[model samples]
Target: MNPWALSGVVLVAAVTFYLGKRSSRYANTTHDFLVARRTVRSRRNAAAISGEYLSAASFLGVAGVVLKEGADALWYPIGFTAGYLALMLFVAAPLRRSGAYTLPDFMEARLASEPLRKLCTVAVVAIGVLYMLPQLQGAGLALEAVMPAPAWLGAVGVTVLVTVNVMAGGMRAITVVQAFQYWLKLFALAAPTFVLCVVFFGTGGAGSAGSLGDPAPPVFREDTTVTVETGASFEVSEETPVWLPAEEGGQRVWLPGVRYEVDEGTTLRFPEGAPVPAVSGGEMDNASWLRPAEDAGALLGTYSLIFATFLGTMGLPHVLVRFYTNPDGKAARRTTVQVLVLLGLFYMFPVLIGALSRMYVPELLVTGRTDAAVLLVPSAMLPGVPGQILGAVTAAGAFAAFLSTSSGLLVSVAGVVATDVLAGKVRDFRIATVTMAALPAALAVSLPVEDLSLSVGLSFALAASTFCPLLVLGIWWRRLTWPGAMVGMCVGGGLVLLALVLNVLSEYSGGWAPWFIEQPALLTVTAAFLATIVVSLGTARRIPDDVNAVMLRLHAPDPLGFMRDRAEARFGRIEDRSRKRGKHRK
Candidate 1:
């Protein structure tokens, strides 16, 4: 364990806690706690939004995916950023104009149906919890890399910190803390990248010489030791010597064309320039890794991934909640634009880091823990005090990623639970915070750590399947009725949920099922949209009586004189009535 890295991460957590405490002063009211009284400026709100949106997937998983899958993985970052563009164009302004604090609030107000509201609240909590698992797992993985701690420790520790921050100041505090974290994350990634680039170029840039997809397999650049944490079977491309567990015998010479099983906790020492063995997942040469899909099935998977990510952003509960913080519709649009720029800038570093890891850290491939590339690569490349400092910087950034995203998710899920399940009050919010945080933290520890990016992508697929249709139809299609929205959410969410269950089971069944399970969004998203439209059109006569008024409120800019006058008149009448009652009583 490196003390400097540990201290740096601790310091970041402390500072985040302090910031949350300081922001608590502004969160006295329920409105403030839920939406910061809708007063956040665009730039700061954008930062907070970006910070929360860039979860474990962006901070760590992207690089790992890129390292293992090569150019194909680049789609993760591109789709992530493009999703915001889709949001800006379609959902941002109108969602903010809806004057709703959460998705359930929007559903209730828009559809004027309590049942629909309850359904949406359930979906929000489900998506939030699913989305949070990867963040927790990423935290555990990062901490384990830097310190001698069980994987669950990091998950539990982060959950506690996030809970405190959320309970302390709610949305107001989370906004301030998350905004700061965006820059911290940016600096943490950018600085190490700059240094690593210098180191790479200074050493003749040989790392960049070959295509990552070259048919030739990767080889160790130096003598190396790799300990398998999980038992895996791998193929030997050439004859090689490997150390074995005591029970298996001291050392054995592995031969070409044979598969060998490496048990958990088994350590293998490889000589310099030896070819890295390919695991059971199948090996990719630089050529295959860098190339786009060469087959129809691969092409389908790529498109499905793109479709899910591009459409999924607007549906993320945590991200959509951030729009509520903006002062107005225009501010919401501005916030999204700013988010695009910030996200684009921050995503560049992770891909580079992943590429570098392929050359410097091939052992990660053998271990099947490529997600650790960002956290492990710096120290591997630079080794010594400088490397430790860089690693510390990366570690701090990673923890910040977990903290910011987890806090935002907690706030979103807790708000839904408080309003829908518990009483909608500050005390209830606190209680809901604890419940929401605990459930996911427990799951994070209990569930096997699957591919971080893939897990998150499943969350995205769910969101895209369920909420994407509701929001799109809700905003643009006036024929949508309460029953239509409810059915759409249920059917769409239900199908995706079914797909998710089948996906888990398919892992055991094996065969062609895994491919469809891995990317359900292509079919599920279309089903959702079709169901929503058909049901909505069929139930056109059941549209709410005040549909015109609601549409005006959602589509019109907030500065319109009549809308302002109407709001003032309503509040003014309430105040006058209160004063008259007071005088009569006296």
Candidate 2:
């Protein structure tokens, strides 16, 4: 363990906890706990939103994917930022104007149905959990790279810190902490990237000579030692001498065109300028990696990814909740605009980091853990004290990624659990926070590591299939009914869930199934939009009686108007009823 790096990470966590505890003073009411009484400024809320939105996928996984997949992977960040534009034009203002605390609250307020609200709550929890697992897993991967502790420690530590902060202050506290985190993350990544760029140019801007897609394999810049954590078969591109564990015999000469069984804990040494072997799964060369959609299947997958990410941002539980924190409809719109700017700036660095890693840390490609590219590259290129410090900064940024995103997810999930499942009280919120944080942390630790960005994209696809349709039609189309919304959510969410399960199963079965599973968004997202539209038109007669009033409130700009007052009155009535029910249960 590099004590300096570990100490930096520890200090970040400590300061985060203190910030949250300090903000707890403002979270005295249920309203403040959930949406900070809708008092947040546009700029601060924008930072907080960006902080939470740039999850492990953006912090680590994007660079890793770009490192492995090249230009095609650029779509990840493009789609991510573009999704916010869609949100700005369509969902942001209306969602905030609806004056709802959660997605479920929005559904119930819009359609006047408790059942659909409950159904939406289920979708929220599912998406939240699916989204959170990758964050925990990413944290673990990052910590394991820099420290001697078990991989699970990073996930557990983040979960605990996030839970404590969220339980103490909720959205109000999280807003302050997450806003600070956005700047912290930007500094951490940007500073190193600037220095690395200088170093690269100072060293004559020499890049990797290896082609990513051809017969030519990646060449190491220096003699390196690679320890295999799991046993796997690798294709040797050249005759290389590899060192194995003494217990498993000794060093042996490896030949080209032969598959080698690299046992767990086996250490291999490759001389400088030697060709790096490719791993078994989805290893692409520079030509294929740089090319966008080299085949019909690749084209479909690319389009599906674009479709999911472009539409998915509007429906994310954590992302949507941030809009509710804004002061009004216009503020929400402004916050989203700021978010696009901030995100656009932040995403530029990751791609550069990814490209740099291909030259500096090709060993990661052999291990099939390209996600560590951002964390590994600084030390590989710089070395010594400077490298250690830079590596620690990157690690701290990675932790901030986990902490910010997990905190947002926990708040959204815990809010739902407290409001819909338990009594909507502070104590209930605290309990739900623990449950939400712990369950995902446990799963992240136990499950085998998978592609972090891919898992996060799947969650986005699920959201696009489920809530995207609900929010789009609910806000813009007045004909939507409770039954239509419910059925659409069931069919859309259910089909995507089924597709996800089949995709997981197909990993074993292999063939065309994997292609469809890998990119179900094209089908699932389309099916969801169609299902909602068709069911809504068919149930036009069942539209709520107060549809005009709700629509007016959602669209109108004046926050102090009659429609706004009416909506607030309704919320007050609902709260009174909820409090009475709680008293009765007590």
Q: Which candidate is the best by TM-score?
A: 1
**Local accuracy of candidate 2 as per-residue lDDT tens digits, 89-118:** 999998988878899989998999988888
lDDT of each: 0.84, 0.84
What's the distance in Å from true for residue 375, model 2? 1.2
Global CA lDDT of candidate 1, please?
0.84
Clashing pairs in 1: 212-286, 213-286, 213-287, 214-286, 214-287
All candidates: CA RMSD in angstroms?
4.7, 4.6
Could you give candidate 1's per-residue lDDT for residues 482-546 as a string of tens digits? 88887877887787788778876765553336455678788888888888888888888889998
lDDT minimum window of 10 residues, candidate 1 = 561-570
RMSD of 1: 4.7
- Error in Å for residue 545 of model 2: 1.4
Displacement of the residue 214 alpha carbon in candidate 2, Å: 10
